[model samples]
Structures are given as structure tokens and as C-alpha cells.
Target: MPSADCDTDHRFVKSKVRLSVKVAPKKRGSCTRKLQVDKLHELSEEFRRELEVRLDNNEIPDQDEDPENEWQHLKTILQETTGEVNGFSSRKNKDWFDENDAEVEDLLKTKRSCHAKLLTYPNVQAAKAAYRTACSTLQHKLREIKNNWWLALAERIQSYADMGNTRAFYEALQSVYGPVNQVQAPLRSSDGSGLLTDKYSTPFWVAGLSTMGTFLVTIGTYKSPPSKTYPNRK
Candidate 1:
């Protein structure tokens, strides 16, 4: 009989293979806005100075005596500095689209209030005119802000490319196009055989391509080439 550990491993591998086949790939998550590099560098300098001051005052943990305490102190300091510099919780990833949505929401609220006022004073044209003006302003500002944002992004991308920083240039492109999502293929063959059967079996990561090639060879058939080109031409 097989050992309990072996049975467990078999079940785990089987489940993973089934899941890989059944589950569909998901789209990439939204990208969060990042702080500028220069701003981050400045924040790092500030953190270092503050840490040095703490050390001088004998307020920081002594790494030589208590390594754990020193680690905790360092971690806390880094978290605080990161929060301040990056606006950790307070900062929102709002683009022009989000800004436009907010402006539209505000305009809706204004229009509702104006309609309420008009219901009380039916002869009032002022509220109606204000609503129309607000609508026009929203449209104009949305187009202006979106156009400016695209112009700024284009300038940023051009600057990175001009500097010959391929990494940054591609990163900028990814920011616009979004990152690609990679999914792993299942380790089982179409015949429901596990790629690796036991400890002595070849490791999946090492022999994955060769195993796939073997599977293809088994499933695929080759047809002999025709003896003569255009045999039916006559």
C-alpha cells in the first residue's frame, strides 16, 4: 500500500492540475500611482538624518546588545517615514477620469438643489440658468484636464526615451497599456497522467519542456510528403 504522505502529495498534485485546467486567466490589477524618484530620495535622506539623531540621543535600540529590539525599532521608523513621504493611506490613485467623475457628481448635486428651489419658486429662471452653466463648465473642464494629462504623459515618455533609459521607457508604456498577466500551464497530460509520479520521478520544472515534447510526439501524427508536386495538374 502507498504511504499516507505519498497519497497526500498525489491528491495535492491532482487538485492543482485540475484547477489549472478549470480556472480561466484573470486580467491584471489596476496600477497604483507611485511617488516620484527624486521625492523618494529626499525622503530617504530625511529618514537617515532622523535615525542618526535618534542614535546620537541614545533613543534607538542597541543592535550589539539586542538584535530583535534593534530590528523592531528600524522597522517602525521605516514604516513611519514611508507613510509620511508616500501619503500611505491618504493618497488616492486619481487620474483625470476619476476627477471628471467627481466633478460630474458635484454638478448632479447642484442640479438637484436647483430643481428643488425651482419647484418652490416656479417663476425663477436663475436656478435653471445656473444648472445649464454648470453643465457647460463640466464639459469644458473635463476635456481640458484630460488633454493636459495626455500631453504631460507624452512629454514624460519622450524624455525617458531620449535619455536612452529603455527600462523607464518600457515602464512608462506599461503604465499606459497595463502590465501583462502570466499564468502557469498544468502539469498533467491530456491522458490524465501526472508529469511526476514519485520522488524518483524527474522534477517537473527540470523536464517540463521535454515531457511536453514527448506528449506532442504521442498525440501528433506525421503525413508523408507527396511524391510529385502538382500530381493532378495533368
Candidate 2:
């Protein structure tokens, strides 16, 4: 049998071996394509037809059915139908930048690889030249990508404005330039006495204004009969 020292050494070696093995992280899928509006409409229609058929067959759960079972059935129907659709997998949210951004990313990766090669062969003139060229190309591609993105956004905003869609135009504006900060009004009474409180609510202010307006309007509307004789004597 192995001695106690030998067993302790074996355990240490096993732990060291386990730590040396590095587990690679799982990679997420890329959104290479987006679903078109027409394709989305088609999917909606298909789902509606399926739901109608289920209703006709009396397959829908009633109020007395278990909530969990009802939810599971609905989820199953949606998932199965969506899986059968061709464009569902590629559907992703729209990005601020267009597809050219992907090309820019690929160019940046190439530039990084070229830089690595230059570092590996520090004395090689060809490696240095290649790295320099990659850097130049990457810069040019980045400028072009940004120019195209801004142009596309400007065109969208202009189109929305021309169509008289102020809401959409503002939405596009906010997306590109970010939201504007709103100025908060001071919460004080008309006389600038103090901050408004529950005792001096908006209705209280409105009622006071209404009473003042009524008094002003009726101040000289009715004249005393004696005032006519006093004006003649003057």
C-alpha cells in the first residue's frame, strides 16, 4: 500500500491536472439577417388561421381549465407554428448601423491578425508593410461605414418629415441625437409666495382665478341710477 505522503502527492497532482484543463465558453449565434415586414405579415396570418381552426374544433381551454395547462397549450401552439415558419429564425431587431458594419468588423479582425503577424516577425519588412496597409484600409472602411450610416439616418428622417409624420420624425431624431432634456417649471403660486402644496392645488388656483375674473368682468357692467344725474351736474 502507498504511504500517507504518497497519497497526498497523488491528490495534489490530480487537482493540478483538473485546473490545467480550460473549458471554452459557449458562443452565441449571430443575427446575420432580419425578417421582412411582408414575411412577418404572412406569419401573423398563418397563426391567425391556425387559431381559428382550433377555435372551430373547440380545442381552446375554458375558464375552468387549469391556468398552467392553458398557458402551456398556448405556448406550444405559438412555438410550433413559429418554428415551422422559414424566416422566424433570422428575425432580429433593427440596428442603428446597416450591414456594412459587419464588413467593418471583419476588416478590423484582419487588421488585428496582420498586427499580430508583424509582432511575431519584428524584423521582417514585408510583415511591417502588410500591417501598415491593413491599418490604412481599416481606417478608410470605418469612415465609409460611418458616412453611410449617417446618410441613411438623414434620409429616413427626411422621408418621415415629407410624409407629415412628425411623431416618426421625432422618434428618428431621438434615436440618432438622443432625447432632449425638459425644463421643469417652478411650482409656486401666482403671487410668488411659496411652493405649491396640497392646500394650494391646481383646482384651488383655477377656482381663485375664476372668481377674480368674474369680479373684474362685473365691476362696472351695472351703473347706479343716481350716477346718471351726478354726471349731468358735473
Q: Judged by lDDT against the true structure, how good is candidate 2? A: 0.68
The local lDDT score (0 to 100) that residue 21 gets in candidate 2 is: 61
Q: How accurate is candidate 1 locally (lDDT)?
A: 0.64
**Clash totals for all candidate models:** 0, 0
TM-score of 1: 0.53
Q: Which stretches of candidate 2 lie over 4 Å from their true place?
A: 1-44, 53-98, 179-234
lDDT of 2 by residue, 1-234 (tens): 222321121322223333566888879777555334445565687767865675566465456578887788777665555455534434233344445767877987887787767667879999989988988897787887778778988999999999999988887877776557899886666567665677667766787789999998898696767644444564
If scored against the real structure, what TM-score would every candidate get?
0.53, 0.48
Clashing pairs in 2: none
- What lDDT is reached at residue 142 by model 1? 67
The CA lDDT of each predicted structure is 0.64, 0.68
